[model samples]
Target: MGRRSVLPALCLLLLLAWGQPGAAQAAPADPPRAPSTVYAASPALAPGAITVHPYGQLQQSDSLDDYDTSPAASIADPLEPWNRFWFHFNDIFYLYVAKPAYNAWVFVTPHQLRSGLKNFFSNALFPMRFVNNILQFRFLEAGVEFGRFFINTTTTLGFADVAKGKKTIVPVDPTGEDFGQTLGRWGIGHGFYVVWPFIGPSSVRDSVGRVGDCFTDPFFYVYPWELATSSELALRFNALGDVLPLYEDLNSAAVDPYIAMREAYINFRNSQVKH
Candidate 1:
């Protein structure tokens, strides 16, 4: 099927899958605690200082590995004033616009369909994964990605996740790789963090990588620019449909949702880069 025809067909399937009962709910939030494994360059932190360690535990100091989940090590935000402005703007957008759109979809849609869409998008982004895996010099991971894409596309129309199924022989690691991560693997710094309008949280390295990853998307090549852009937006919208319920609980639980999100994003991205 052509790219234009594919998304609509998927949406149709999603609608059909929506009526099934017993939709799963997002799990309740857990109590917060200090982090077990902290990411930092320092080996010899002062006693009671948040225990810090890098990706590889070569520090060989038992005291450093003590996992304490204090707020992640703060990264420099040179544009804090502007970043905070956009941060609140994005929060408002999410609260009023994106969340409502997601809510409307979730009310009508089944969890199964949402999961399938997430899988479909994950599978569809194989080109980005394959290229980045190669760039990272992880030939084995690149080969596994190639295998998963080949099998799933041929057998399941790229929507069904055969590689991830119980009967599957192919090993599929759904974690994505991109130019940003490739840069991370190449020892480039994160530069600085920023809260972009509509795009939410990101860093200088990741933002530039996002630009590069766009060209790696197969839809960019096969579809016209407008259609490709719309298709991507639709996919993202559908993906967001699954997580809408958690936003309220997260906001309620966070002492300061803005800081919580920023710290979480920074720490999470740093871990990804390290690994």
Candidate 2:
């Protein structure tokens, strides 16, 4: 079916799924935690209900393999009550809404097609990365982005990355640069914490930076609101595939998934700023 038909069906399915009761399964054994970081999930949430490692931080689609729940630095959370409220809000949305819908999309779509969609998204978002690198006067990194963009675009039409591994030349994408990082590099501190529903962990500065990053993305300008919104969401969802299980492990282990994600996000962004 065409995406237009599929999308409405998907939304209807999401509502229906959310209304239905979550199935009961025999509780599984506790998953092992990584040595470097202990990922934590909300105690309120059942271990196997649904796994969602969401974004803005999670949204960026950069490497999340190194998320450390216990971090050395943290942001001001004067908005803790507000943050926690939405944390749970997003938690419920993920538990019932996102996973089921995403699974159906996965079922209908081929594996190769999913992989290509992920690659295509990363490839398409080069402008935001390239510009932020330039804004920070990281010309060398910007040049590298340009090189990778040209090679990847020409070689695969943005469907696959032909840059590195085996017969390698260009390095992997030097991700984590953005308007938020640019603002941080320009001496902007984490101006308190804010957790948005669906978008997850963020700060006042970073939240504003999200608006800045939006301008850098071409998809924001796409005509017909439905296609633009769907394309953007497809980018986030496709990028989320790898990190879902990561959160599953972490969320299962955590006492408070919200705090775990918050601390890690601070540390993650702090590390990015220095680079």
Candidate 3:
């Protein structure tokens, strides 16, 4: 059936699924103490540092393998001169531009404004991801899909690319799982932590997946000149506000933000796989 025809049915199914007796139960909270095995091997760390690194060397090795396998990393191999140039550019944009914007969003905005903006952005993307979530059978995919679709559609006119049949553009469905989740389903464990300049920290697999996602984003579909600059800024501001809580939680809890982020990424990715 066509998407329009199928959407209503999918929404009904989701509503029913969510109503299941146990569906409302919250997920187990992250353990207060790190796993004992982690502490046993790294005796130098204080008690609080135990959960900081879950898989240890094994995780790091696995991340390296994913980095080696990721097509984006291959194309932008750190050793290549052109790639290095681009990486530097990415760093400048992220550190000087995006990071500052994100910081402003967190610290400068009034709480009510931040909350309202986040809701506004999230509400805009809800319809698209809600439909896609059913199609892909992954709710997290639906959630990320919502964020991506909102960003592209509002800021860059990305939805037009999908309408035009640009297969390179990421699909708008939330049900579609990310590459790292796909890797995990294939039984590959998450490995070491690496942070990219603009994109933030992600394993080799997730980093590659983000590139694939960017291609599908609506931003590529819009002529940069055609999109309103103010609208774009608003979207970024809203996006940062929405994720500020997650950033704060990560910083407050972990001794190493990189490792904490990696674990959170993996945990979120794994949740997608199950859905």
Each candidate: RMSD? 11.9, 12.8, 14.7
Best by lDDT: 2
Give candidate 3's TM-score.
Answer: 0.42
- Please, what are the lDDT tens digits per residue for candidate 1 over residues 146-247? 888888888966777787744333333366566776776776767777777777667787777776676666766655545766676777788764444444
TM-score of each: 0.69, 0.70, 0.42
Q: What is each predicted model's overall lDDT from 0 to 1?
A: 0.57, 0.58, 0.39
Better of 1 and 3 by lDDT: 1
Among all windows of ten consecutive residues in candidate 2, which has the lowest summed lDDT?
Answer: 14-23
- Which wins on TM-score, candidate 2 or candidate 3? 2
Tens-place lDDT per residue, model 3, 1-275, is: 55333332322211000000111122223333321222233212222221212211112222322222221111112223333344456546645676687787668777666655544444443443355344345555455555556565675455222222324233332233333444444454444334554445455555544443333333323444225223434665556533444445554443443334444554444444443
Best by TM-score: 2
Model 3 poorest ten-residue lDDT run: 13-22
Q: Against the true structure, candidate 1 has what lDDT? A: 0.57
lDDT of 1 at 129: 86
Using TM-score, rank the candidates from best to worst.
2, 1, 3
Instruction: Quote the positional error of residue 71 for candidate 1 in Å.
Output: 8.0
Model 2 C-alpha lDDT per residue in residues 143-208, reported as the tens digit of each score = 777777898899998888775343323332334366777777777777777787677778877777
Work out candidate 3's RMSD over C-alphas: 14.7
